[model samples]
Target: MSTSTMNPETADRSRRALAAEQAASLAATNDWAHVDKDRVHRDWHELYGEIAAAITAGAQPRDEAVQELVDRHYAIASRFYAPSRDAYLGMALLYAEDDAMRDWHNSYHPDMVEFLGAAMMRYAETRL
Candidate 1:
């Protein structure tokens, strides 16, 4: 394994810690008054699973079908924050570079984070 890559146990711990920190931050800034947390969670889980299946089926990041998936991903994300083009690309960077986020995404498929990041980048550049 690469020196930069954490071991599974360490990665899990790191992910949990990061999640806690993020949740705290989000709670402080976002009003959760009307949101259905469970439904949003389910939507994200379903979307991630679909994206994973697309990757496993050899879909390229710029493929039309893959772009459709990215569209849904962006729409869902916009419910929380509608990012500018640069912000969306920055998020793509996080998907591929953040250890905890990358590992969480990769759990769906070995290349899920990279695939999704590329797709998101493409979507941002061309569509957004």
Candidate 2:
């Protein structure tokens, strides 16, 4: 990992490329692609990014706002992943297991990986 911080412009550009690549990878393997990657990334960064900031500021996984964020997380992920609860949980786990995913979250906030996992589990237990 590089020890440099990404400026907003650079980060946005990098995120777009990464999103497009991941969409292509998913499509190549699964026979479908999410064409609205910019929208997806925009929402993910704006909404989920806010949640990560809240977590960093000491929000608990059980918080109502946090749970709502988890709901939004599941919804957005369904565009790129699967819509089932099982797939949602699997993705929650993958955030921790995948180096790129985990690193990307950590890049924005240090507590993000575990915080998001806990929030997703809580959401699954309470909602799904």
Candidate 3:
């Protein structure tokens, strides 16, 4: 409760989280138009957790369950990124090569990003 007892790192993280939530709301209100930022983020978070679990369980990129999760992932992604082969392919490559994106994905699990990248490319190849 007191500043002396509070962990600075935990307090900083809480502050950053609140700031991010406010920023998301402001973006949606100012320019996002019809997009529901909260809903999209919540759904994406759920899907990412599930996808990470599947990958940790040793589900291959082309596994039936993994494919289904990847499809759901793409649908969510398409809400922000226009649904198309190029967009999906770009996202796949981004996940694979972008340092910031890789760090975010790796925060979920060590291999989650690579697994999602593979599934993204596979989905693009087969569905797009």
RMSD of each: 7.6, 10.6, 13.1
- lDDT by residue for model 1 (1-128), tens: 22134355644544454455445546865764455768777888999999999988899989999999999988877665566665566566567777898898899999887788778767876998
Q: Report the Cα lDDT for residue 74, model 1.
A: 83
Clashing residue pairs in candidate 1, if any?
none
The model with the greatest lDDT is 1
By TM-score, the candidates rank as: 1, 3, 2
lDDT: worst 10-residue window of model 1: 1-10
* Residue-level lDDT tens digits of model 3 in 1-128: 22223355644453454345445655765755567889998997888888878877889887778888888887876565444565455565556566898888788879877777777656766887
Q: Kindly report which residue stretches of model 3 are placed more than 4 angstroms away from their true locations once superposed.
A: 1-31
Looking at model 3, the pairs that clash are none
Best by TM-score, which number? 1
Q: What is the C-alpha lDDT of each candidate?
A: 0.73, 0.68, 0.67
Candidate 2 residue spans exceeding 4 A from truth: 1-30
The alpha-carbon lDDT assigned to residue 105 of candidate 2 equals: 76
Tens-place lDDT per residue, model 2, 1-128, is 11122244643454454455556658675744544788888988887679867976889988898988888887886676544444455565557767998998777788787887778766766787
Which regions in candidate 1 have their CA more than 4 angstroms from the true location? Answer: 1-34
- The true-versus-predicted C-alpha distance at residue 86 of model 3, in Å, is 1.5
Rank list by lDDT: 1, 2, 3
